[model samples]
Target chain A: MHSPHFSVIFSLDALTGALFLLTAIGVVATRQVLASLQLFIAQSLLLSLSALLLGIALGSPHLFAVAGITIATKTVLIPWLLRHTVSVEVYRTREIDRVLNIPSSLLIAAFLVVIAYAIANPLLGAVDLPFARINLPLGLAAMFLGVFTVVARREAVPQLLGLLALENGVFFAGVAIVPELPVIAELAAAVDVPVVALVVGLLTRQIHKRIGSTSVGRLAALRER
Target chain B: MELAAILLIPALASGFALLPTNRHFAAPMTVAATVVVFILASAVAVRTTHTGRVDALGQWLTCDGLGALILALVALVAMTAALFSWGYIRIRAGHSERRKEQHYYALYNLFVMSLLAVPILANVALMWVAIELTTLLSAFLVGFEDTPEALEAAWKYVVLTTLGAVLALLGFLILYWGSQVAGYAPFTWAGLVEAAPRMPPALLWPAFLLILVGFGTKVGLVPMHTWLPDAHSQAPASICALLSGVETTTVLYVILRLFPVVGGTPSLDARPWFVGFGLLSVAIATLLLIYVRDFKRMFAFSTVEHMGIILVAAGLGGAEAHLGAAYQMAGHAIAKSFCFFAAGAVATVFGTQEIAAIRGLVRFAPLTAVALTAGAFAITGAPPFAVFISEFLIFKAGIASGQYLTIALLATFVVIAFCAVMFHINRMTFSTPLGSVPATALPLSCSATLAVAAIPLVVIGIYVPPALQDLLHAAATAMGG
Candidate 1:
């Protein structure tokens, strides 16, 4: 009875990790702003699913709380905020402007995955958990990819989304390795993330209004004279 | 119960700020509430000194000597800022700015409430939450003016600091994992410190490094310090005082909290990293000072410089050095806030933050000119000033610890910074008046606020009160003295 449940949990965890990597790729590869936002929602949903599975497998109430938080904030609230930020015209037509083109960004992301695996290889042997071995590498890769997205993106909204993506990766790693992390911390992040989204959205809108563009490259006026 | 009041009053005051009645009474109420918080914070500090540590609310809120010291600093700075705001806001707020008054005070109170939470939190994760709260709360305050420059500064502050903060969360999570593996429950600082000696070096080193780089960003350590000048320069004068004087120290308190835990790990020293980052920040900031054009931006860089000094003192790793670090934290808090208050007065009267735009403050406002000059003198570590005493201790500690090279380099950078800061402020205060300076009188509240800030700088310089000395010693020991 336990073996079958364990097998199901293991497969679900693997699938979640794979989906995390896929959505991460989709976030960077998409050219349209709305499309990138949709990919982020997919990524967050996968992260929530992973959290839910971990909660069921471990029978921990706290993991279940975290799962609820990830879904409530990331999957539901943040995407809505991002969608509301862009008007219909900009939403439909805005190019997800990037410092690097899609093919190159994808290539670098794959390189980061290889680097993550390399870094995780030595750390893996020290841990006895079977699931962490798979989850940790995927989490690290996603983190690297998220940071890359932040650095490469020129527009404000994508940078915000990239930061959220990084948080998702961190959450994945935390759930995999330390499922018993106090519920308060997860709840704080859950509370804080939406507020951040609200502020960033507000700022992005203001930036658009004042400067007539959301491109960060145009904000070079405040530097030292 | 006092702790509950300490936290609740500011939050309540913030709520009050939005009410119509608060419009006429906001400044007075803010000052009154902050003074009450100051009294409560001193009581907690005294309790911690006598007992060594206090845990309340079922171990959720913890206060050690370190917490007490930082708490007192936050309270002290908050009070001064409130008093300063009394005049600063009155002068700055006009017809167009009337609607922003409520928003400003509300955010100010919430910001203070967040800083107050940091020292009291026992759980590392919760502490990170409090620190992140400070960043989020103040982002709006930083960009309060809503000008293009202010908005840009606010965006950089939120983005850079938030990124650094998230990295800190990752670091804490790793430590949580390590603590669990070592058979301790997660989240408690004491538990992690107790389990530190048994933890693997690989896990401990990465955790420590990640935390250093992470919190170091908020501390305005170089390379991650791009946001500090912008945020500080853009925020209101009183808010600038809080950010420069108290906020960085509060964040540094987080790094020092981890010292005893990470210092216990056998294979990791963690000192070299601190020293390297500390000296690098100091050297870089000093170089930038010579080229600084804005007085507020110059003071902002000075904050980065002082943070480096505190970090290096702590990083030197000796009883003397830890003690020096504690004193430095106190002295810099008092002195830096004084600089910001004075600089704010100068900017307001002269109607520009640019160093070149204003001259002969003495001719325009004799009293403020004198206050600004004294502040500059104290902040530059001039003799008989509070900062000089703390800096002397730090130098002595470095010599005792045989960090000869780092010490010599540190001294050179310190001297260069002194020269640059003095040169800039002297031109602004003592040189010929540049234009038809506005004849706005410095309000009595502003003068009183400057005196209140100045008294500590002089008093602490000449004599360390017995209670303050005891608080410093206990705080030093808490950091592995």
Candidate 2:
């Protein structure tokens, strides 16, 4: 197999990494739940692209397998499961409110990106990959943003999307740093995600069915009366 | 051969649980599976005491001193939980009874399978996968009723624990990378511990803290333990036993496995973190216990309190403390399972979990009232019970090591928790009958399981069986005693 020059692969991967970060922001910033979820799909797609590029760049075949798993599980399977579980009526009734306003959240997210770069900077010199120093920080930044989204969003679906984004960030960092991470760990995690998605989706459906809304804040009534 | 048998039993049980059998078969099948597992697991525990370790498929599956002890505990509780499920499902409401029973049994087996996998697996990565699977499987069981409360509990459980697991995954990856840097390939627990001294402090310390925080969530450590009470309270009683008694310990098993590795690091101090988190958790859970109104939630908080006690013992870093921690684990598992079973029986009889509504249980269901009282006594570390012995050992170890302030604080909280636990159970069991109390027949399964659990609580209190004592001593050594 003919291999592309190092610079070309690196540029493409860097672009995908950039797009990955942008989609994570899109998820946190979007007002509509469906749009937020759709942005997660976009984030997963970029994650798969980055993984594919890293696989080709590093000459590691397992990253290709990881890329495939990412696409199949995160991109295709999870989105389909979620869309099927959520009714279209949910869209009209639910525009997810943020605990922090969007612009402020985005500002905090950008600050988190700076912290990520700082944390990633020192660790970069120790690893083997040269491109990892560039890609890993963005991955870390995305993770920070995703966690912010989980804590800042009140709805079940948006919070779920936030968790997915966090995972995508972790996966990107995993490939950048330790591409040979055991296939078993990756595969087991891949298989486990769909189960988590299915369970969480079913649970969301149950919450909506009984409570008529998936606002997690409204669940405060369970305490002793 | 025994290791293979131990793993295969649960795997096969999970498969059989999925079969399209009549609803009548679910309980019996589940009971049979758990019984077989208990027997095999006990045999393996005994053999590990004599044999020192059991390995199969090379290092893919291994049961060492610690693993055997934990595996035995898992089986013991799973058996009780399975039996408890028989009674729990019989009286449960608000669902298609047959389908719900079938699904409950199926998920119960799968959950047990993952719990089994946690201790027996040799590789850290595989162990993490197993622990993650336990959460994935049990979160559904937590929401099996599909009520709003159950769903809310399940959602919080999945999101919180899975987030914790992700951090743990990051920790494991870094450990794996560090292993490679140190020239170890497989990243098994043994390999990681061996290579830990050479691992750079930058990698070792962060990985250790990440794992502590990550698995700490699964262990239901404070701040991260918000999901525990809700999930445990909302779940069916039988499932609560496994989740509280077994799953928490199984995940904490990961942290314990990492302890020696972190100890092997040359420059990092690990004890303060354990002690800090342990003290924090105990403090929070103790305060919550005084105000807990829901009986199941009270027990759930007690589980948190017990986890803290065990962690404190481990953090003491004395040989006696490690042994005490092992004994605490066994005692807590038995006592907690018994309490949950009795509470389930009482809830079934009274049709409510509110402690206020449960006045004069003795007048209504005398046997469960007796079991509940005994369980509370045993769990609170009353004399002539297993927890008393373990807690005493911990106190002795703490004093010997000159942790006087921590011990004083521990004693204060223990007394408060004891009074609080006893107060609730006493009011529930012996309070005046507020109205016409029905004389409902307790389920045979509930009574039988509690009877079985009572033996260990009483026996281990007075005398630890020689075989079990051997296993506990060996386990203590495995943890660096």
Please give me the total number of clashing residue pairs in predicted model 1.
0
* Candidate 2 residue spans exceeding 4 A from truth: A1-4, A91-93, A125-128, B93-96
Taking all chains together, each candidate's TM-score versus the true structure is 0.97, 0.96
* Clashing pairs for predicted structure model 1, backbone only: none
For model 1 the interface RMSD, in Å, equals 1.3
Off by over 4 Å in 1: A1-3, A83-93
| Weakest ten-residue segment in model 2 chain B by summed lDDT | B90-99
What TM-score does each model's chain B reach against the true chain B? 0.98, 0.97
Kindly provide the TM-score of model 1 when superposed on the true structure, using C-alpha atoms: 0.97
lDDT of 2 by residue, B139-212 (tens): 87998877788888888888889889887877887788788778856677778888998877777776788899
Please give the range of 10 consecutive residues that has the lowest summed lDDT in model 1 chain A. Answer: A87-96
In candidate 2, which residue pairs get closer than 3 Å at backbone N, Cα or C atoms, i.e. clash?
Answer: none
